[model samples]
Target: MIRKLLLILFGMGCVALQGQLAYEGVVLDADTGTPIPFVNIGIVDRGVGTISNENGEFLLEFRPREVQQGDIVRISSLGYIPRKIPVSLLNDDVLKLIIRLQPNPVSLEEVVLTDKEYVEVEDEVGYRDLLGKGIGYWKDSVALGGELASKIRVRKGLRRLNTLFFNVLHNPSDSVRLRVNIYEPADKWGAPGKNLNESGRSILHVLRSHEILTVIDLKPYNIWVRDDFIVSLELLGVFGTENISLSLPAGNLPGVPSHRRYTSQGSWERIDDSAVGFWLQSTFYTDKPRKANKPRQLRKREKKEREISGTVFEIISSGRSEMRSRRRGATISNYTSNKSVKTDEWGRFRIKAVKGDILGVSYPGMYQVLTKVEEISFYNFQLYPVKN
Candidate 1:
């Protein structure tokens, strides 16, 4: 009689295990039958979700009382079509299934060009220098890991974007791989919205150490901006080495607002205090001219007798007195010739000018200063803070 009771208790435990609700699955490419990683899986109309691991395997658990019969599970990825299956279709016991996603086919638009000349929409006048530091995935901070985005508006229609330019600085021992994504604004809140590129379509570049300007050709992608768009650079982490950091050169300028950066692949937040590095110089051309064009003769300006060198510094106001520090990445413009160059990291700049030639010096958060090139070789200027 005791042995029979023991057998009955073991049977009850087995039945309880079978009644638990759990789902485990592997995501793969439908055509190749290969594993796919980073696929987002979630319950339909429910916030519960998880992403596939590197091995393309995922496990989701539900309480026996909370799961419904007709509930749906959805899985989606960047380049594949999303798939959904009903909970009632799964097995009551340990449900294990293999789900496959088909590749999304992207259709390209036709291009027709009737004009050879193009106009510059935005120009990167090197002005400010700010470094974006790297933070881990979870920590909420400035210039951390994830994506940084900026907005650009197109005033005219039928303009095709030809090129994009930006700058980067990285460690000499490591190489960084990054992706450039263009998106249409979701709303007027100045946030990055839906991606404009087709599924899996992106511009990837490998960056090395030192300051270098990166130029990407967007013509093959046929990306045309109608009203305005957002440009984002995604840091995919460093390759070949570990524990290395990469940063982009950012600046502050009048008429240009502070850009936005997102952390841990999450929502977009504006960088309220400073402008993030990298300039977006977009060249656009239209097939038809909006107005008639007329040729005009250009005027020639006189040459300067000497070149002057200088160091720019910013005045930081404290409680009583003020302190001055090197103004890195300031723009020194020769107003006579309309030529400009950025100051080095040490805030030192050298430009050709005469005694009477005017030098326009400007940096973000400081008032513009125009100083006449005095008969001095080494001139120094201090930029005052803007009044509140």
Candidate 2:
């Protein structure tokens, strides 16, 4: 009997040692077909876990007994949909799982372009900084009860070619409006006669205006690509108009030189002469700022306007200079205070009202957005294509 017990104990030790199991695969976005790095992979019962690498690949190990063929393997991450697969059904040692994640449907306080001039083939749409940390942009003075706020920039290396997205949030009760305004810089590269040129392509004239705002939806996943519409027009041969080029247009090659030339001959006049402008501005708001402790003054003759009106949201293009730009006579409306103002060439604007009042800000070609008046000025802005 003692001998039998010793044999049984030895058998148990062998079972424990033989329980090692391994799994490998890549996790990616099912919708856009993009890879998701740092995803968490785990065995449900064994408490074993592993992380996906930069390529969204992972290798996980488990005790053979703890995770059987029919057991479940779980995979998940932020800004993505989670998934669980049956281990028994997975036949291959290497698995490629495309896990689609929906965009977070939260209010976007700000959008940041990690790389000032990002150019990459991959889709780098999600926010990269540590969650909850962001920078804000404002247009008005934060001192004199202005609605203008600060600008927000994200911290990441966004591929130069990938289109960046910004998510803005608003109270469900508040009406959040968005207008897309595109401002394209006229051919600053070319003289009335001499065309600007850096490469084979001549900056003789504006070949095609670069579109500034691609996606301008206040809601999630509701992206409207106007470029696609333009392409469809060219394809369908909608109207007889200006010159059109059919030779394959360039894919998003960030920092890659453009091939099209303004002049018939492929010659450039200047070393670094590219003339274009894409001006964008947005107007939005949060809760108003607190009033100063000083006593209030009342005007005896005229009706006094509130110190803070509504909040203003503004975002301008990155590459262009603010000096050459200006905002003129744009109107600001409120139930209590109806006013009109224009930004200087730098795309600046101002409004006045007491804190807590709702202000609606709108520009000629931009989406109109509303924000509460705050003592601390805010800047909400969007980019619009500048037409010739």
Candidate 3:
């Protein structure tokens, strides 16, 4: 049964500030005509996200001027192709607002092996440390409807991912729904981009009781990856009280910098106020042993010698050089590209620069200094405390 989403325009009724409207809709399977549960409904990178209820119904509130002609609301779900709707189509007073999604099943990859025997390796790696405190969302701060992602560096080649492990820093809610998503490193700034989990099945987990550590099996998906990837724990919904957080210790092995963003499409700010730690561990099987990360001190020396050819960019896939190159580093946010980098204490940083790029040097309390890229390859910045 094919159905068009029925939307009725309220046209700034009652307490109208430009145009007041309420949006309520239901998601259904295009072929089955049955309600789909837990469908992700949100504006792309706009920091707006919500999930359909068990009844396959959802309601999201939007402020005036929030919707534009080209803006779209994305509906993403497991075992279905993502759907997008234009903002101009939204309205109110519709009884049967039906949105249908088509199924998208991922084709499993066939494995081929040669007779040559090599090595089989199993490894569990991530920041798996339990300390006194962690990032407490909803409780410590407001529940931002987005994901908190941390970069997880892995070796190059194929690895059969086994389980994803995360430490629950705190969970005051009786129950909550969480989604695990894996992402490929973006080509532009190396931020989390392009969903890598091609299984077409949502890795959903429900928490009944609070446990210090939670492990999710990845073997069922048969996921394999090379180079570096990102793991994010997304908050789907909160049952009972609004208290849920994926926690890690205060800091990593040290010198590792952390960045925070509210929405998938929101702007990223450096977590420079304090060294907040974020670590996600995963176990995987491979045919070769993992390469040991070079010591930071050694990598630093090699960097000063410019042996890495500046590596072009400081963010390396191995992440061994991430902290080695970012300790006491100044954060350089590329306003033009929305990418950020940090200059080491020696006042050195690297970014893919082009002409007319507006770069801002910022700190938590100080005013930001914006510098336009000309023919210069170096810049110096000093921040003073904001006036009271």
What is the C-alpha lDDT profile of model 3 across 45-114, one tens digit per residue?
Answer: 5655567877888866557566666787787777887877676565433433467788886676687887
Off by over 4 Å in 1: 1-27, 35-78, 82-99, 105-145, 170-173, 253-265, 272-283, 287-388
Q: Whose TM-score is greatest here?
A: 3
TM-scores for all candidates? 0.47, 0.24, 0.61
1-388 in candidate 1: lDDT tens per residue? 3122111121111123455544677888888979886565666544345556657887655555655777777777667877776665555433355777898776666877654765433222222234443211211232222566766545554445545655555354356656677878787566676677664655666665643555555656766566677777765445565544555566543444434443223446665433445433334444345521211211112233466788999999999999999999999976533457899999999887666455678898897776666684997889998889
Candidate 2 Cα outliers beyond 4 Å, as residue runs: 1-19, 92-388
Model 2: per-residue lDDT, tens digit, 1-388?
3122111121111112265655555676766667776565665534455556658766665566555676666665545546676666443322334344444344554765553332222122222221233222222111110111111121222212112223222112112111121111124432122111111111111112222112222222232221101000001110133322211111221221111112111122231211111111222111222211111321311244433322233445566653223444445554223234655545556655555444555576755555555554555544343444
lDDT of 2: 0.34
lDDT of each: 0.58, 0.34, 0.57
Error of 1 at 45 (Å): 15
Lowest-sum lDDT 10-residue window in model 3: 306-315
The TM-score of predicted model 2 comes to 0.24
Pairs clashing within candidate 3: 45-265
* Backbone clash total, candidate 1: 3
